[model samples]
Target: MSSAMFARDVPFERSPTTDLPVLLPPRPRERFGWPKLTTRHALLFAALVLVAAGAAFAQAPDAPPAPASEALTTAPATPLSVVVKWAPLLLKGFIFNIVISVAAMTLGTITGLMLGLGQISQNTIVRRLSWFFTQFFRNSPWLVLLFFAMFMIPFQVRIFGTTIPLPDWMKAIVGFALPVMANVSELLRGAIRSIPSGQWEAAESLAFSRTKTIWQIILPQCVKRMLPPWMNLYSLITMATVLASIVGVGEMLTLTAQVHAAEGGRPELFAPLYGFAGLCFFLYCYPISKLTQRLERRYNVKT
Candidate 1:
């Protein structure tokens, strides 16, 4: 009985014709260098060798001088020296750019606050007037506005027998401020509109006047929504200050051009000096952009 049970439990071998799944081994991780160099590795190695050879040739003492005519026609070859010599002046001009942007933005923000509120005024005339102002400034090309402020605005104003002449930089600032005001007004209007009707109803239930409700309750909430856009606008305006050079505002670009010319317009200096100017703008604007993005995300505001 024990021998019979063992034979039954052991079972029989499978028939040769029976089909079974084939189990393949996992693929070996493809390697790159030496004995196992792949197409990708070959290409990368070739590129690296070419770069090394080029660098060695460049540093070699026997390297030939550039043709005199080519050298003369091109920008300065030594940009670092030029930048070193002119850095102070460029920095001064950059400071002016900063000052102008800040002043224009400040003025624009104050004016925009009033214009935005006026757009929602109970009186039809006030609303229309605000809309007209916003559209006029918004639709006008910035260059044209700059030209108008530079030329059409009277240079001298007589107040109590006192005559004052507006400087070119001041006119540029005012020109820039108009567009900023229009944009900020739109931002404010949108932020206010974004609040739920429930908020307005709640304020009204508290017996608050419209102005009081806006100032005390509504605007406080809108601040979070408005701040990110406000910072974004400032960055744009900061970059736009470069345009002031067209009107001879003596800003960084203007100084760069002057320095480049002073440096004999050498081809080598062209990239370095201009690149330095661009770097300055980048350094100034990049942080603002990052901050704006962070604030927008934190407040869950889209603009």
Candidate 2:
């Protein structure tokens, strides 16, 4: 082929004025469509909708005005003032809820890690027992578990001649942790199983012990796969902390009710106070959920 033909086929274009090859800028990657709508945006939109609905309901027509003397004597406190005054107390209870969630998650994760390993063990008895407990707790209702923990567990126990108090909140933590442990166990089992069997065979070929293979090779790979789901589970646990209130643990919802009663039980304050509690939870969990999504995308593996 002539040099002229090779020149004509060159990737770069020749400069018209100087007769020298000009390098073209690389083409930009094409994006397919509109920007993705994220979870945060969806949450904010839902919050706005709730706010609008609450405002409309608050402005709904009221009963006819009371007699002037009665109205002057019985005027209820403004809803804004009531919420603002009680927000700090409500926040303390909310912090307690966060503490319960963190404790439960920690306890659950540690226990679940052991259970997950058990499920994958070569011994038949250990595997079966781990599977049974995982299935039992995973399928049970959360509230029922809370009630069980509350009634069945003792109020206190003595160990080494020392009496230890077992408070309602501690029982509540146990209740929440049961299901979380089971779920984590399942998550881990699934993540480990998702790894290719070739990995196990390759480790065997290298004469690596099964335990060493799992710890050094298998589990490390599973971590990326497990993280996104684990974070999602944490968010769920955080939200479910509110359920502790039903069992008489003074979480945010319970405190909200007390605040309403303390503020004379004005019917108008009920919605706003509970709404405020929901908003707090939304604020805390939303970031976690957004991070989980990003991690899922970043760690996504193509088949």
Candidate 3:
């Protein structure tokens, strides 16, 4: 057969015996580095290296000696030993941080969705108000907002003559949620606008109402576009949970501080303890970031 006869549209090769076109196998995806070295394995390896380094630093003979008072009162313990001893308590505090992040994200997403819809509303007042709020919270410093919530908001409220006390962490959630809501509002608005104008025209041509078109058509498409960024935002929120330590929320960092103080405020323990806290956050958020990258690639639009 001539080469012209083999120039077919389908991706296939001819089988010698049957003279039939055999379908080609899919191309293998390219992977960087070693085949068995996954992200999890790399992270675990890095953690081990960090632990080993910290141990070496702690036990180094050339390290500074403890103060006379501290040395006399408390027996010296290895950094790893101290960390292991308090791991349970530190972990409990870390769980609280996760809870705070989750609650804030949920509350923020709900409010943000409504606010986002408002930004594109036909009503002038609604659109302007939504825009204003979105800008206001989005631009404000997160730390300032957190501080405002802590001091300005009351510790309790009387509703229907029922006295309900508000805790510090609850206020912290509200503080964190405000910025999250604003950012999400902006995210939603941007995602909605990214859809081609032709889609709107097509939906209108079908006699689909604005609300129906948005809910049924535009939003479904936007979900994939929004997911990666939304997840990235959640990772940021999770890491920011450490800021709660400043306000005495008893998160991991705060507990770590308490542990340090309880352990005689040993200068040597400072780096390892804080480093461990950071590693916890890294392990948690790094996976989220990697997953976000994978999703972004998967859902990427060629156009």
Residue pairs with backbone atoms closer than 3 Å in model 3 (clashes): none
Quickly count the clashes in candidate 3: 0
Q: TM-scores across all candidates?
A: 0.74, 0.81, 0.82
lDDT of 3 by residue, 1-303 (tens): 554566565578889899777889988874432224479888886877677566658745564678888886655798879888998998898899999999999999999999999999999999999999999999998898899899999999999999999999999999999999999999999999999999999999999999999999988988998899999999999999999989889899999999999988877778777777887887788778877887888789654
Off by over 4 Å in 3: 1-74
**Pairwise lDDT winner, candidates 1 and 3:** 3
Error of 2 at 172 (Å): 0.7
Provide the overall lDDT of each model, using Cα atoms, as 2-decimal numbers.
Answer: 0.82, 0.88, 0.87
RMSD for each of the candidates: 16.9, 6.9, 5.5
Q: Can you write out model 2's per-residue Cα lDDT over 80-119, one digit (the tens) per residue?
A: 7778899999999999999999999999998998999999
lDDT of 1 at 286: 73
Task: Show the lowest summed lDDT stretch of 10 residues, model 2.
Answer: 28-37
Clashes of each: 9, 0, 0
